[model samples]
Target: MQGLIISALIAIGVIVLLGMTIRIVPQRNVYVVERLGKYRTSLEAGMHILMPFIDKVAYKHSLKEIVRDVPRQSCITKDNIEVSIDGVMYLQVIDPKSASYGVDDYVMAAQQLAQTTLRSVIGKIDLDKTFEERSEINMEVVQAVDEAAQPWGVKVLRYEVADINLPASIKDAMEKQVRAERERRAVVAESEGDRQAAINRSEGDRQAAINRSEGEKQEMINISEGEKMKQINEAEGRARQIELIAQATATGLREVATAVKEDGGEEAVSLRIAEQYVSAFEKLAKESTTLLLPSNLSDVGGTVAGLQKVLKTIDRTQP
Candidate 1:
């Protein structure tokens, strides 16, 4: 029984020794080691050995990326608007020794730095820009934090703004402003439409008036042309009638002259003349006019003398 008890004790001591001397680090993990309470080396993936109690794991760090939530904080914008801002950050431990010894807590340092940087960036812009320029705010925070966190063995990959909470009064005022702007645009558009419609109607009326005037002008021109044609036709008819009358008178005169040239033409013409003189006197006396008798009315020689005087008067009157 004493020999069995000593063997069990030796086995227990060996297991404890093994546990103190060996370390199995998982993949993408780093184990910081300290010798006599001083940083010695970093143990990586797989198995490692330590020098008994002289070396011990101080800090454990992951090589993979880490996500940390940035605490919500109140920030004032350039416009003096207070807003609540919160975000998230992506980071990774690049150097285990620096991460362990460089800072008390890399995650806290990075998060605090991110918050302060966000506040500074937000203060530089207005509240309206805070909502619109989220990406810029995030980038500024990431760049500033990453630069500051380099000493802590942390690589800040990305920063994202999660939410921006505006005050209720500001939201309501913005809604009212947007609605008024829309209403103003609608009124302006309606007025423009009415003005265009009025312009179109005026143009239509002007065109119609022009068309009517042109029609009237054309009608007047047509009437003038018709009147000119009618006047020309009537004048031509009157000219033709005058020419016919002159021709008829010339033909009658020619017939009379031919009859005068026949046998006994001179004595018949003298006797016909005497009869025309007697007939013209008789018609004149019938109108209650005075008539004077010739002293040689019974003599043929005196009558011939008087007929010769009448022929001279007729010849003087002809063209």
Candidate 2:
């Protein structure tokens, strides 16, 4: 019974020894070893052996990137505007020994430094710039925090400004100003459209008036040309009729003069004169019921002889 208890006690001691000496570090993890309360070595991934009860794990650090959110804090700008600011920070531990011995807590130090740096940067610019230049603010904060965190083996990758809140009164004022600007632009655009439309209408009216004038001028010219042709044709027709009448009268007079020069022309003229005188009496009797007889109406031969004598007298006078 004493031998069995000694064996079991020895086995239990071996197990405890193995547990203290051997260590299996996870991926992307580091274990810092201490000897006599001083840093001895740093353990990487996989299995590591240590001096039992002399060498122990002191600090554990993660090599992976870590993110921490910056708490919201009230900040004053250069323009004396109060705003609430919050952000996030990306960090990585580069050296485990420095991360352990350089600062009490690297993450807490980096985060606190980031908050103070953000306040300082925000106080330098105007409130409007804080909203517009967020990326610049973030970059400034990252640079400042990273530089100060170098001694703590904490590398700051980047910082981002999450939100910047403005007061309600300022928001309302900005909204009113934007609405007024939009209204002014709309009014100007409408005026420009009206001006353009009026110009188009005036141009159309001017063109229509010009076309009407051209048409009226063309119509006047056509009417004047037609009148001119009509007057010319009428004048030509009157001239043709007058010429024909004058020619016919001249031909009849020539025929009468030629007949007068022929033989028996005097006797024929006398007989024709007597017949015309009798015919004139007959025409007057038919027009009226009363007839005026000559004093020697039954002496026809005497009248005929008297006309012959008058014809002989006219013949003797001719050349």
Candidate 3:
């Protein structure tokens, strides 16, 4: 019975010793070891053995990336506006020993540093810029926090500003300003459209007037041309009629001269002349109030004889 109890105690002791000496670290995790209360070395992934009761794992750190939320804080901008800001930070531990000993708590330290850096960056710019320059502010915060966390074995990969809250009154005022600007632009655009329409109408009227004037000018030219042609035709017709009358008169006169050259033509002409003289005197007596007498009024034969003598002389002179 005593030997069995002793064996049982020894087995228990061996189990406890093995459990304390051997460690199985998971992937992406590291263990910080301390021997005799002093940091010995860091254990990587896989199995590790330590001197039992002397070497102990002091700290466990994960090498994977970490995300931390930054608490909201009030920041005053260059324009003296108070705004609330919050963000998230990405970080990773590169050195286990430094991460364990360099700072009390790296995650907390990084969060506080990020807040301070964000405020500093915000205070350098206007409130309006705070909303527009979020990326720039985030970049600045990451740079500053990463630099300060270098000794703590924390690498700040990036910082993102999650939210920026503004006053309700300011939002309302901005809305009003934007609405008024849009309305003014609309009015200007409408006026521009009207102006262009008026210009188009005027241009149309001008073109129409030009076309009408051209048509009128063409019509007048056509009318004048037609009138000119008509006048030319009438003149030509009258000239032809006058030429025919003159030719007929010439032919009649030639026939009369030929008859005068024929035998007994002189006697016929003298009798005709006497008859025309008497007819002329009778017409003169009726048309006048007073009777007009020829030089040989009492002797009509003497007048006839003088006319015959003048005719004979004209016939002798003709070729």
Candidate 4:
């Protein structure tokens, strides 16, 4: 009976010991084992054997990516503008042993570090840069957190600044600045167009003035040329008239000399000369209103005697 009791007790003790030594770790999970209050080894997924009273499972962590939202925290920008920023971070445990011993609480440490680093980085940049460059801020936060968490066996894969909060006054000011800039550009463009138009109009006016002046100059030149031609014609007509008068005077003198040299009797010549003079006077009277009178009536006898001598000479020369 005692042997039966001892066997039953041994079986119960074996079962309890087996329970203490054996551990079932689920997939995507890690267990940090500690022996005698010190880190011994890390156990992965599947069955693991742990020495009773010698080795203990200290911490269990999931290897899968974990995401948490960082709460909004006030930060001061480089330009001394106060802002509130919030973001999310993705992290995973790499070494379970280090994760258990390297840090007290990885999640709390990461959250606080992320907030501090976010403020520090944002404080180094202006408000405009902070508002415009969210991705850069996110990357800076991720890098800082990853570097700090490296010793804790935690890998910070990525982080993102989801939203930023700004003062109403700043938002209004930015909007006004944009509107003013657009208006200024519009005014400049309009002024430039006006200036160009004025230049074109001035050029056109100058060209028109030049054309009018040229036309006036051409007209004056034509008038001067016409006057010159008219003057030339007048001079040529006066020269022709002088030449005709000289020719007629020479012919008249030659006829008078021929008549005198001929041996026509003076009385006969005087009668002929009188008749020729009357004919010329009658011709002049028909063409003009002015009358020509003899300068001396007593000289008429001398003129008749001279003509008779001229006729006699002409008659003698006929032989």
lDDT of each: 0.90, 0.90, 0.92, 0.87
Residue 179's lDDT in candidate 4? 99
Top candidate on lDDT is 3
Candidate 3 C-alpha lDDT tens digits along 172-265 = 8778998999999999999999999999999999999999999999999999999999999999999999999999987785676677789998
| Global local distance difference test of model 3 | 0.92
| Residue-level lDDT tens digits of model 4 in 1-319 | 9999999999999999998899999999998888999888888889999999899888999999999889999999988888889999999999887788899999889999999999999999999998689889999999999999999999999889988888899888889999999999999999999999999999999999999999999999999999999999999988988998998976775666566666763445577778886688779889988877778645766766666676556556653
**What are the TM-scores, per candidate, against the unseen true structure?**
0.62, 0.64, 0.66, 0.54
Most accurate candidate by TM-score: 3
Give the range where candidate 2 is weakest over 10 consecutive residues by summed lDDT.
252-261
lDDT of 3 at 133: 89
lDDT of 2 at 141: 95
The local lDDT score (0 to 100) that residue 193 gets in candidate 3 is 100
**In terms of TM-score, which candidate is stronger, 1 or 2?**
2
Which residue pairs in candidate 1 collide?
none
Which residue pairs clash in candidate 2? none
lDDT of 1 by residue, 1-319 (tens): 9999999999999999999999999999999999999989999999999989899999999999999999999999999999998999999999999999899999999999999999999999998888788888888998999999999999999999998888899889999999999999999999999999999999999999999999999999999999999999999999999999999987775565555557875567678777877787788789766877677657755676676566546545555
Clashes of 2: 0
Q: Write the per-residue lDDT of candidate 2 for residues 84-186, one digit (tens) a residue.
A: 9888999999999999999998988988999999999999999778878998999999999999999999899999998888789878877899899999999
Q: Which is the better candidate, 1 or 3, if ranked by TM-score?
A: 3
